[model samples]
Target: MKRLFILIAVGLMSTAAFSQTKTDGVHIYNPEANAMADLKAATEKAAKANKHVLVQVGGNWCTWCIAFHQLVDTTVVLKQAINENYEYVLVNWDKDHHNDEAMKYLGFPNRFGYPVFVVLDGKGKVLHIENSSYLETDEPGANGKKKVGHDVKKISSFLKGWTVAAVNPETYKSK
Candidate 1:
């Protein structure tokens, strides 16, 4: 029940939330081209479309990446919003296979942990970089990841805010 709010992948259902097609889950493109070339192309595409590109930096091994994927899968409103305004790309942070220099080129001169989210625009310029810890609080060490607690709501709101007809939170009362 509580877990449903974190959905990061959902189909493009009607506004009524009834039925959606199979392609709702993010296409999650692979080496669409050489990393830099792909990044450049994605940026060009985003810019031409006048929308933002969401680049998720993590591979199959990262736990938070898995969690993020699950959340996106279930986050209906966010999915809809993303489907509307943003083009998403995932930069694989492969450890053993090794893409270190590329990741550094992408963002981290030093390095960034898993689940690093770098948002870019059509021109390939960055819009936002959300790489904080999940807690967003000061802990012992570990750099205290930013809290993902209310972010589900925030992500949903951000998506809707970028759209034309925002989803009024109360209109789902029928549920």
Candidate 2:
């Protein structure tokens, strides 16, 4: 009887442990994902599509990261901008998996903070490291009580600025 009880307790504990890893439908970062592999795949896809790679580096544990992702996911303009200009991926960074190799390749974007944006060219070369704070709005959010969301315009502009055509020298040639 004692052994059965112990087994049940252990099962319950394991379930709880696993449940803590997920947020309430806002899990943008996958701790178990191979970020390096994902980034390589994104770069390849971007190259073929003539687009850039937009990597959002943060863990599901970060509230702001979740908020930013929620905004981008629900906003039509933001989604359009991303789809038109870049291949998007979320790289997890947290206590359990810091993704050290990915971080080094991305030029240590975490130095800025959680939810930092790293723009990479088709060849996997780092082009820009954007601190997410710059994309946030000074005014309060929809509830008009909390200043915890990103500005759609700012994010759209950022995405547009890093597109392949925007960076190509020939794009500016007088025709």
Candidate 3:
């Protein structure tokens, strides 16, 4: 009985570590109205804000995608970086199939491999595109320290570089 209780306690504790943090500034929606006007309205808003539209393209059934989703949900740094720079849009391949522009921009998933991730500029232009590169599977007991996908430090570093006043690689080029 003691062993079972301990196991349950550990399981609950483990779950606590991988849950979504409170999102205060994240715009967690896309404008898909099955019509032109609503889509244009959303697009205009994106343009006005100069926000990067991060389209996470995957089927609703993908566990890897779900893990990434959970990681984004749970990691505070990930949320911070994302909330500051981008408007997140979950482009469902199975149900929604709404990322036609992003798919065309990426051409094909070559770098990170499938599960395409697209970053679009304020004008609805493609800035960068990426793919899934899971360091370790999301299975329980998977090494947390070695998990590269949601490493807060690396992600923060990238955000810092991408958003600095004069050295932002996301916008300007040194010539």
Task: Tell me the deviation in Å of residue 76 in model 2.
Answer: 0.3
Q: Which number leads on TM-score?
A: 2
Give a tens-digit lDDT track for model 2, residues 1-175: 9999999999999999988645666666889999999999999999999999999999988988988888998999999899989999999999999999999999999999989999999999999999999998778667877576788889988999999999999999999
Worst lDDT run of 10 residues, candidate 3, spans 27-36
Any runs in candidate 1 off by more than 4 Å, and if so which? Answer: 1-33, 132-150, 157-175
**Model 2 local distance difference test score:** 0.93
Report the lDDT of model 2 for residue 54.
98
Which tens-of-lDDT digit does each residue in 1-175 have in candidate 3? 9999999999999899777454334333333423224334445666677555556666545556665777778988888777777676665444455456444554543335435566656665666666456333343346544433444464455445433232345456656
For model 1, how does the per-residue alpha-carbon lDDT over 1-175 read when each residue is reduced to its tens digit?
Answer: 5455434234333333764223334334343335666677777877777677767777665556666666777878767767667777777655454456556666662155776766665666555566535323333345566443325765564555433233235645766
Instruction: Quantify all predictions' global Cα lDDT against the true fold.
Output: 0.58, 0.93, 0.55
Alpha-carbon lDDT of model 3: 0.55
lDDT for model 1, please: 0.58
Instruction: Kindly provide the TM-score of model 2 when superposed on the true structure, using C-alpha atoms.
Output: 0.82
Least accurate 10 contiguous residues by lDDT in model 2: 19-28
The predicted structure with the larger TM-score, 1 or 2, is 2
Q: Rank the candidates by lDDT, best first.
A: 2, 1, 3
